[model samples]
Target: MQGDQASVIGGAIEFIKEMQQLFHSLERKKKRRRSLSPTPSPKPPSLAAGELAAFCRSAAADVEAKISGSNVMLKTLSKRIPGQVVRIVAVLERQAFEILHLNISTVEDTVLYSFVIKIGLQCQLSVEELALEVQHSFSQESAF
Candidate 1:
């Protein structure tokens, strides 16, 4: 009886040790995978307001404004604003442009993005058009 008890205890200790080793190995594998994965480069901040607006207008016209995200509140013509990154908060499709709202807040207001301006988290606009529009818009603002 004593010998049998000793064997059982030893087997239980061995099983516990094996489980600990297996857990350690799994943790090591996860760490290795995390280290080996490639890191993506950061995207440049979108500052070209005119190009963004034009891109919004043309792209909105092209796709018939079928987009989704934080922007969903600006359905009226008066609510639409150019030259800003309006994150789509919600969406409702119409014949022409998608009605969207944003998820941003200000000292006096809470604004919505109101369009498919940024497709899949990145705003789409051609570089040359963007540069030209930015210059023009800034000049216009300065003159005003």
Candidate 2:
């Protein structure tokens, strides 16, 4: 009876050792997987846009008419700012009258993405004027 009991104890010890080996192997595999995984990167802000040339082409007739026509008011001319990334607050026309939040970059060249948001009605708004207004607004706000 004593011999049987000793053998049973030895078998239990062997089982425990096997379990420990398995646990260590699993831990190593987990570490390897983690090392192979890619680190996450911060994402840039994204905006949807129509191409400048394409938008111009689509709106060409209206643009030409406005340019040639003597009655074109600045308010009506305010909508044509190129490269203007607009987050629309409201849109009144397929080609005009949009309430938009403009994003203009000041960093220089394509690196900065220079364009400004403006509210426009009737004909398209002028890009240069909107940019000036936005810069002014930002300066004034910053000063205060």
Candidate 3:
């Protein structure tokens, strides 16, 4: 009887060890997956997107027009701000809007970035970050 009890205890220990190994493998796979994707999203307060965010609101108000079968409209224009060229795009829906700002410096030749704002919220009362995630998806998938 004592022998049987000892064997059961040994079996329990082995089972626990196997479970630990399985859990560790799962954790490693999860981490690896996270690492392979595009950029992680930045916090809104830290995004340096003040200009872009306001542009989204104004763009929403003054949308030139909407493209059929697609919600994206874009225009590239030289910046009034000296030495800057800007490409602007607006993605509009019933309650949400996404705007991409591609700013290029004519003289620097090295400074360029794209700021995307997704703020056409489905609910008027929805949180700001909720709209941000839609923009985040685009940035996460591509670097520019």
Candidate 4:
């Protein structure tokens, strides 16, 4: 019985040592991965002020046109849509800028332009979706 008890204690210690080694191994792997991964740029790539202004204007104009054309959009909402679109574009642009800087060594003008275009399109889609929801809500309210 004494010998059996000693063996059980030894087995537990062996298991604990194995677990410790495994934890250390995983920690080492995590450190290695962190070292190998590309670090984010200290500062995001600077967007030219002129280019940014041009993009905002173009995006706002496009949103205005869509809102104007939509029969279901309320006049008040239509007035606000362009400003909202600009805000959305600003947020998206900041995120995209960070992501671009992190993923690529250098950002090109064309790539930035394309990202802006995509952000504008996304904002347009969001506005359209909001319009649809508003229209549905209005229709439902009218029914009662």
The local distance difference test score of each candidate is 0.32, 0.31, 0.33, 0.31
Candidate achieving the largest lDDT: 3
**How many Å off is the CA of 90 in candidate 3?**
52
Model 3, 1-144: lDDT tens digits are 999999899977964663454345335434655689654422222223322221112211111121212222222111132222211232233335555433322212122223333445353522333333333323332223
Candidate 4 structure quality by residue, lDDT tens digits, 19-124 = 4543453354346446996543222224344321111122112111022122111111111221343343344454332112111111121111111122322244
- What TM-score does structure 1 among the candidates reach? 0.25
Per-residue lDDT of 15-44 in model 2, one digit per residue for the tens? 466345434533543454469965332122
TM-score between model 2 and native: 0.25
**TM values, all candidates:** 0.25, 0.25, 0.26, 0.26
Q: List the residue pairs that clash in candidate 4.
A: none
What lDDT would candidate 1 get against the real structure?
0.32
Which 10-residue window of candidate 4 scores lowest in summed lDDT?
103-112
Candidate 2 regions with alpha-carbon error over 4 angstroms: 37-144
Residue range 20-124, candidate 1, lDDT tens digits? 543453354345446996544222224334322222222121111222233211211112334333222222211122322232322112222223233333444
Candidate with better lDDT, 1 vs 4 = 1
